[model samples]
Each structure stands twice: as C-alpha cells, then as structure tokens.
Target: MSGGGSWRFECKFCNTKYVGAHNRVVSHLLKDGGKGVKVCPKVTPQQLANMSKLLNDCKERVKNAAPKSVPLPSSLRNAATSSLDYDMSFTCSNPTSSEVGLKKRKGMGTALEKAFQNNSKEQCDGEIARMFYIGGLSFNLARNPHYRRSYVRASNIPGYVLPGYNALRTTLLQKERKNIELHLQPIKDSWKAKGVSICSDGWSDPQRRPIINLIVANTNGPMMLRAVNSQGEVKSGEMIAELIIECIKEVGHENVVQIITDNASNCVKAGALISAKYHVIFWTPCVVHTLNLVVKNICAPSLQTRNNDDVYDACKWIRPLADDVSLIKNFIMNHGMRLVMFTEHCNLKLLTVASTRFASTLVMFKSLRK
Candidate 1:
C-alpha cells in the first residue's frame, strides 16, 4: 500500500508493481508477461467488489461532468414531438403539363409506368436474339415454356412486340446472308486478278457421312466456298478429282491459283489429275501433312538400323521409348479409374488423341515428360 491512503498492487506473475489500480496490474499479468511468467488465477470476492465499485464511481463522475445540451426552440420542439402518421392526400398549387400527364397516366399503375418509361423490353429482346444467334440455339428452344416465360419477363416494355419463330428465322437469315455478301464483295473484287488458293479437306461426320469442305484464301481473308456431302459416291481418285474440278469451276478456274489437300493416296492421285487437267493452276499436298508424315516415319519402329552405327541406329533406340510412351498413354486414357487418379495425382490433363496426326503423339510424349 502507498502513502495518503492510496492502494498499490504487485503482480505475482511478473513482479510488476502497479499503484492506484488493481485492474492495471491484473491486465499486465494476463497480457504483457513473458512465456516464463505464470498468471495469478485467483481473485478474492472483496477485490472483485472493489473493482465494480470503482467502475461505477468513474461512470458517475463522467456523467456529472459532461456538458448539458441547450433546450430546443418552441417551434422545433413541436415539430420533433409530432406523430409519424400523416394524411396521404394533399393539394398541389401549380403542377406542370408533364406532371399532369404523368398523374393521368398513373392510372395504369407504377409497374407498367416504370416498364414503359425505361423501354428495356426492346433492348433486352435485341440482346437475347443476338445471344441466340451467336450461340447457335435450336429452333425448338422457343417452344420451351421456361424460355417463353423468361422472354416475357425480360420484355416488359410497353408496346413491345415479339416476333414469331418463322418470322424471326426468315428475317435474321436474310440479314446474315446479306451482311456476309456485303463483306465478301470487296474481298472478291480485290482478289480478282491475284487469284485465291483453295484449301480442301475431307472428313466424316458423326453419322459417318463424308463431307468435303473447301475454303478460298486471298489477301482479304479465307472464306468458305462450300461443304459437300460425298457419302453415297465412291471416294476414288477420279471422284475426288471431279469434285476438285467442280469446285474450281464454281470459283472460276482463272481466279484459283493453287489447290491444297492432304497427302492421302486418293488425294495425291487427285492432285496429279488436277495438274494434268489444268496446266496453269498448280496442285500440292499440304506441307503440314507432309511434315507430319515425315515425323511419323522417323519415329516408326519399322525404321531399321542398316549397320550397327549409332548415327543410323538412333531411331532404333527411340522406337522402344516411343512404344513405351504410347503404352503408358493408353494405360492412363483407356482406364477410367486410372485416368481420374492420374489427373488428381499428377495435376495435369493428358494430351488429347488425334489419330490422323503423328505430331499429336510427339506432343503427348513431350507433355508427359514435362
């Protein structure tokens, strides 16, 4: 205890002495001590009562010393004392013509008024139509009740008219065709003398229907010429040659400088025939396909070492490694459980298989090595 009747306390945990307040000493013992210091866990009932009395006295002193607020004026006091409830009906002195029109139009209700004021329906319809076109939505999408409800919800503007499916389809299709033609006209005109290269590829669709796609490339850009279904006909060298000739004729033979195709046997024969038929225009196999073939041959196990020399036998060593890689890839891809485990454990996606390209195998191996 200190002089002049002041109380002094010392923390048992840290030997820290505090004067005039046991609370400070308690707080210090609890919070500010080092790891070695053990806190004093006991508090007597008398000490707790003394702390509570001290807190109450401090609060009373603060309340007594605080400055009092000035009394409000009679008018302000009356306003503040008024009840919250008020009459809804009121008189307007000089409302404008627009305000009068709005009041008259208010009979239609607030929801309709807001919708008509914003005109969001037409804007939303245009955007939705654009989204449908860009995403290639099916015609049957409009038949869905959910879709119709969504459309109605979005098109809440007054005087908004929704187009029928047939009308929308006809209008949008014609617009798209006209837009494409307008864009292609300048390109065609620019390439009139320079001529375009025709790149063609054949592939089978999901239903096993063979489709031949032709793209004409010039300085402007590459534009699709056509996609022809050749499923029923024999896909022979002669048939492919005839197809190429027909495409060339349609594109104007004088405007086509070169033709490109994959190096398949039929395609090779077709190119030869095309060159023979049109001496002015050149025909060549796709360079990418040729390089892919070269890589395939280099990596093939059939490449035998002629002499036991390391230089010539390098491929012989690579062949087994490639075969092992292919085996590993097949093990991971063919088994669903293993595939999931591989993805989870390795944190990587396996390379997608592309049967037609040898480069794909090389890429897969490289990814696996990484």
Candidate 2:
C-alpha cells in the first residue's frame, strides 16, 4: 500500500491494496472485487456513506471552479437583442386585433395568423424576380395570366410586382449582354501579345444537323470564337481548312501560335493545309484523342484468329466482356425497374460508355467490376 508516493487504500480483512484514483478505491469498497474475493466486513454503512459524500463534494467543487466564459462585446450583444425585437415588431403590429378575434372565436385563431408578416414585400418580390431571371426560367412564364395570379396569391401579400416579359426580353437582357461584352474586351486584348491556340470540333445534333464549334485558348482562358451550322454541306478537308483559316483571320494570324484538332483523316488534312498556309503557326492532333485511339487499338480483338489457337482466342475475351458491360449498362439505364433493382442490389450507379472516346469503355468496365 505504501510502495508508491500516491495514496492507496487497503482492504483491512484481506489486506489487498488498490492504488490510483478515488473511483478505484470506491469500487474496491462497494464490490470487494465481486465473487473473486471475499467482502471486507470492516467497510461499514457509515464509512461508505462518508466516502460517497466526499466524492460528490469534490465533483461539485470542480464544476464550480471552472473559468467562466467571457461575455460578448456590448455592441454585438445589443445588436443581437435588437434583431429579436425587430422580428417581434413585424409580427405583432396589431396585437389588439388578434386578441379580439381570439375572444370571439374562442381559441380558434385564423390560419393567416401563422403566415410570415413582413413590411418589405416589395424588396422580397424584387429578389424573387431577380432569382427567376438568374435561374433561366422561360420569359413567357411571366406573361401567363394564370401563373402571374398564382404567384401573387402564394405570396399572400398585396402589390407584389413581377418582372414583365417585354421588359426582361428587350431591356434587361440587352444590358446584361452589353456588360458581359465589356468584361470580355480586356480578356481578348490580353491574349494578343501572348498568342493563342485554336481548337475546333464538329458534331451532329440528334436531328443529324452538323455543327462545328471553334474555340481560342490563351493564357487567360478558352473562349468560344464561333459555332456554325454546316447546313448539310460537305465537310471535306478543304472545307474544314477554310473554316480554320477564317477563324485564324478573325483572331489575327500574328496572334495565333497553334491549331489542334482530332485525329480524323479530314481534320489531319485540314491541319496540314492550315500549317502550309500559315508558316508561323504549328498544327497538332489532340493529345487526349490520340491517347484514346491507342487504348481502342489495344483492346480490339485479333481479326485473323485461326481455329485451335488458344492464345488468340484468349486475347479475344476482352472484347466480349467490354460488350457485355455496355449491354448491361444500356439495359439498366433504358428500363426504370431494372435500374432501381440494380441500384438496390449492387449499390453502384452504372456509367455509360462514350462513343467518341475509347477511354470511356475502360472506365465503364472498371466501375462495373467495382
């Protein structure tokens, strides 16, 4: 019991000592190590009660002696208190009207009593109109008589002004576009000295109308130069080369450093033509598209496989697995019930393979395996 400097308690009956905190000492007295050891007859009711009381007193002293938190600054405290008062004032402008109604109705208050009461209905309505514009809602929604009435009714306030369709279309839209153009002017000017790279890509919409987009990239960022509808015209290498040359003229031949396009035969020929036309500008294929082609080639099955060739047949297994993965993705995505079941059973969402990029197939398979 006296081996260490810390206090220790000894069981007088068995002479077993416990050293450490007072909780250990209390446990020894109450349980006497349970059935593993005999109870100490020397621990009386009075002694147990005294020890319990002392332990509680020590805890209370600790609780009371903790450092009190510093109060908030007087300015902040006053501001917080005033905010609550302001909210109450808005809600209780006519307290007598409510109390008189309460007496007449006998505890059946009107439902309108719980509604938000505000003096700034005009400001709130203006904010709603701004949000509608920012959210890209159709301008015709404002002109609809029923929708306008419904919106006003939902606010439960009078004289809430909604933005007019004509004003939004003619005035506000033009002003916003003008402001954006003003901001973009400085960015365009900064790209002149450092030179820019031009990237072009062509794709067809769901209706099969061909569209070509041109983008210019510089130290600042990429900016769309133009998007043209090919209008069912032939997109030969000469046509594409002409389009690139026209964009370079607009961007200034001196300010252009390079042109990048996908590795299609027509695009490659177009790039070569552009390089020949402009001696200073270099032409290169898109690195991402080239790498994707490499992956596609590696995964393609050997077309010249002969019968009884085990290695060639084994190498062809990847094509079927890739196809199966695509099929499963399409099946689940095309059917709502199957999609829900797949989500519940697998706990993973299916990813679609991108037809334009072969790398997407590899990623889709990896996610399916996971």
Candidate 3:
C-alpha cells in the first residue's frame, strides 16, 4: 500500500512494487529507481544497465538539440539595448528585468547612471529647462502634448522667466500704439478717392485705462489702428476731436468722408470735426449702439416721470416676481414651446434692429429660456 506514506505501484511484467515521493515517478523511471517496480526482482544487472543507457541516450539528444535563434544586426542589437536601458531607467521598469542578489553586483555600474552622474549640474538643469521650454512651445503651436504636460512645460523653470504670452502681447500692443502715429504718413496723391469713412471706438482695459482705436477707410481698404490720448482728465469732446483729426490727416483732408462712431457724446464731437473741416457729413450713431439704447429706454422706469422713486419701485416689483427661480422654472416647463417662439420673435426684432449681432446668440437665448 504505502512506504513512508507514498503510494506504491507494481510492475505488470515483474510484479514488483515500489514506493517513492510525489512527482518522482518520471525521474525515478529514468534513473535506476524504476528497477524496484520491475516484474522480475532477480533481473540481470546487464539488462538494468541497458535500460539506463537508453534513457541516458534520449536525454543527450534533447540537451544537444539546437534552439531557434532570432537573427538581428549588430548595430540594431546595440541600439535596442541602449533603448531598453533608457526605458528601464527613465520610462519604465519591468519586474522580470530587475537585477537580483548581491553576488553579481560587485562594482557592476549602470551605463545610464554613470552618464547621468558624469553630466554637470548646470548642464542638467539647462537641459531640463530647454526641454520644458520646447515642450511648452510645441504644445501651444501644435497642441500635441496633453493639457498637464503643456502646463508642466510652460511653468517649469528659468526658461519661462517671462510672465506669459498674454503679458508679452499687452507689452507689444503698448509699444505699437506709441509708434503708430508716426506710421500714419499720408499716401502720396491719394486725395482723388472721394470721401473716406472712419470707424472709431473707445475700449477700456482690465485696469479701466481707456484706449481709443481709430480706423480709417481710405482709398485703400483699411488703415492702421491709431490710439487716442487717455492720460489726463477724460474729456469726451477732446478725445473724439483728436481721433477724428488723426484719421483725417492719415487720409487726406480733401478725401475725408463721414466718420462713424457709437452714440457716445465724445464720438459725436469727434464726428462733427470732419463735417466742419472738409464738409463731410456726420451720420447717426452706430446701429448696434442705437439698438442697445432703444432696449435700455424701453426698460427704463424713468419713462413714468417719478424718476428714481418709480425705478426703485419697479425693480422691487420685478425682482420678486419675475426673478423667482421656482416660478421661472415652472413657466419654462409648462410653456417652453411658447417661450421659444416668443424668444425667436424677439431675436428677429433685435436682428432687424442691429443686423450685426450673431444669430447664434439668439438661438442660445431661446434655449436658455427652456
């Protein structure tokens, strides 16, 4: 049954039983251990030697057989090794490829580690900074890197010493404005192109410092953007007049046509100059501005004659009723289609009032009502 708790098997020919440890069957057969389970317990030693020799011959064949070798060029092999080392050090480390034990580690230094150590600190820092700058620039120009990588590259180190592209843009704009007046030299003999149309508008920066842009439609299509003085006490009349004259001089005074601007008083004063100097007409304020003013007037509470008292009272009424979130939500849910129709009509009216406003905004507002 069992020898040392190992199950025993009998040989069919010799009727001999043998027992051994687990998984020892295959190896024990190849060795002389299989002789114990032979049918004949008194088998000749010569026969046993012949069986052992046959097993040994089979093992030699297996061991001596040539394995398939992957063909690789020497150069390619070296390059692949270098790439693998780089990946293992900087990119990734596979558990199977990791070095083991202290026996083979006697002064066996990594080539990559040695190269890194050989590099000067300043050189490494500069290289890192350069990589960051390059990565950031490539991301902005082509948007190749992901958002995180782009941010990392842009914010890295001494490479990004400048505030940002936005700051550089603003600086460039300021510099251009100072020297732009000189660039407005009148075109030679361009007085024969009839009247010129001028477009002017004042815009305040984030800091609330106003800058006026004066664009003139000369015989040629569009002229450069010129700046108006915004330093001293802000005077609407003075600002408009200065902008008009500058545009007029850019395009010859004789060729001066109508000047267009929003309904700002200063713009009105500026427009009036072209009419006075060159007999050019001052048209009504810009259509977009007129539409905004019309809307404001329609909504104004001062139309009731009580002025501030009526305005405050109207605000108190509207804020509580129309501004109620739950009421608005309910109305939208119940009469959403009707609200969309009404909004569409309102947008059409607005479009007719200012033809320049984007239709997409109208559609957007219609959806928001729902």
Candidate 4:
C-alpha cells in the first residue's frame, strides 16, 4: 500500500483519482451518496454496510474507551519482570519473542511527505522512550510485537480510546488467555496418545521465596504449566503430591506417563504418592540431577570409622584439597590483579564449583587438570 499521507490516490476499481489516503480510500470504496468523494459504483450494499460498521466502530472506540488505563500483554511484562531475571520461570503464553524490529516504511509519494512521516515516527519513538523512563518499564519491552502494533492500531483510528485498567486486567486478560489457549490446542490434543511427562524443579526468586515450576512435555516439546510460590506454606512431600495430583487432573490422568523431580526425600515421597494415586503413571528422579549426585559423591573424601585409630582413609587429603581449590578459585576471581596474573600463567580460567549443581565439581576439576 502507498503511504497513508499521500494526497493523491487512484481508485483501482474505477481508476479514479482521489485527494487523500486511508479514510478517504475507505470513503471511496463504499457508497455514501458522494459525500465530497464518489463511492465505489461496484460495491454491494452488504459490503458498504460492513465497511461502514467497521469505520464506525473504529471511530466509536476512541470516544467510548479512552478514559480507562489497561495493561499491555503479560508476555512482555511478566517475561521481563520475573522469568528471565531469576532464570527459572519460563515464558509460556503470549511470547514477546515474536517481535520484529521496526524498519523504514516504503511506498512514499515524495521526499517531503516521506520526511514528514519519518519525523512523525521519530516523535512516536520519543514518546516510547519517555514512557519507558517515566514508568520505569524495561527497555526490553520495546522489542514486543504489541508495543508497535497497539500504537499502529491506535493511529489508524480517529479518536481511539485505550482500554481501562479494569478491562485490561479482567475482560482483556481473559480474552488474551483464550487466544493463547487456542494457539496451544495442538499440544493439548497430542497429550493422550504420546503420554506427557510432568517435570518440576525448585527455584528461589530475587526476593528469595521458593518456587515450584511445572512443565508438560511429550515428543513435540516442553510447555510450561505453572509456577507456584511456596512462601508461607510448608513444602512437604504431601503438599507437593497434591500439586502433582492437581496437574494430573488438569492434563488428564490418562495422558500422564510419569512425573520427574529431584532426588530429595520429600520429592521422592511426593513421587511415590503420585504413583500410588495414579496407577497408570510413575515417578522418576531427573537423570541429570541423579548423575550430578553421583559425581558429587565420587568427589567426596573416603569415609573412615572413628573407633579405629590405626585405620587411615585413602581420601583424607581430598577434603582439604577440594577446600583449598575452592578458596583459591574464589581469591583469584575476586581480585582484579590476581585474576590477571592467573590468566597470564594459565589460559584456562578456574571454574568455581557451584553448590547448586553437583556436576560443577567435575567441571572445576577438569579446569584444574588443564
């Protein structure tokens, strides 16, 4: 389509010239008894009415809906706010990953008109910048598809009213959820045949509150189910088992094959409870976590009986050695000059064994061996 700002337009149907674009283009297509622009001679009555209703709705929304404040899609807000920041919560519905960055618009009538459009877009960009600054919203939000699309839609309407806060949180939120659910229908439909696995893991957010994340997966791929905050409530085997049962019911018991969790006793108990409740399904420990545990055990110092004075464990030196390695890694990484000197001596950086993941000790040992 040519630029909406063009003062000249040729009607494709009749090859007739018009003085404006956009609304005028719309005005030209449907018969309105020549209200300063000739209506399309070929347009059916039903088509004219439909076009008029669309235009009327566009005009009415600005007058009727502008006073209320509503939120943008949670795909942008929740993803930027909680998901990627703490690195546990996953992006599920309404992903902002679909955003396509803006580009220079095409099909301009002249340099003067193009300059005007460019300047207008720059002003809009200024408003977006101001919005981020004033609201303390993430700059990453601009990357969302809706960020530009909502503005483009608003611009097309003469006096388009923005949705209210109540509408955004209530009506529009529900509407968006339904839309996203429709997109997820294919995955939901595959649940029965393939038998999905229910996987969960624990995390702590920035506030340090515990979170239990759930995801459902088959051969297709993983889909995040939910993230529950276990703040005030006690996180026990029974408590976690309830959550698993709830999820099983939601996904349908027939569709669930197994539940996967860490090797913690409580989680093991939870799995047992789930297995007992749903006879068709079973519980299993995460394979990676299990292997990590094996690595951690292998790296531990050998055990010895305190009653035997003559007995000396073969791995008595290992405990102190691992501790010394950890201390050295920390010291080198914390100091700038020490790190520089260490890097000068060895090209490979020392790896710190994270207590969170047991396999990190193996990685640390590998670095030391180099």
Task: Compare the candidates by TM-score and give the number of the best one.
Answer: 4
**Over 4 Å off, model 2:** 1-115, 118-163, 204-208, 301-316, 327-340
Task: Score every model by TM-score.
Answer: 0.55, 0.54, 0.39, 0.57
- Compared with the true structure, all predictions reach lDDT values of 0.71, 0.74, 0.54, 0.76
- Maximum-lDDT candidate: 4
Which scores better on lDDT, 1 or 4?
4
Q: What is candidate 2's CA lDDT for residue 298?
A: 49
The C-alpha stretches of model 4 lying farther than 4 A from their native spots are: 1-114, 117-122, 145-158, 161-164, 302-322, 333-352, 364-370
lDDT assessment of candidate 1: 0.71
Worst 10 residues of 4 by lDDT: 98-107
Clashing pairs for model 1 are: none
- Candidate 4 lDDT over 1-370, as tens digits, reads 3456567778777888877657678768866444478878877788778878988898898878777433222222332365333212222223333321111223333577556765346445655666798789998897899988988899899988999989999999999999998999899989988889999999999999999999999998888899999999988999999988889999999899999999999999999998888888999899999987766655663443334434335434556778888988888899999999988999887887787876787678678878
Q: Extract clashing residue pairs from model 2.
A: none
Weakest 10 consecutive residues of candidate 1 by summed lDDT: 70-79
Higher-ranked by TM-score: 1 or 3? 1
Could you tell me the lDDT of residue 306 within candidate 1? 50
Clashing pairs in 3: 13-39, 14-39, 14-40, 15-39, 196-257
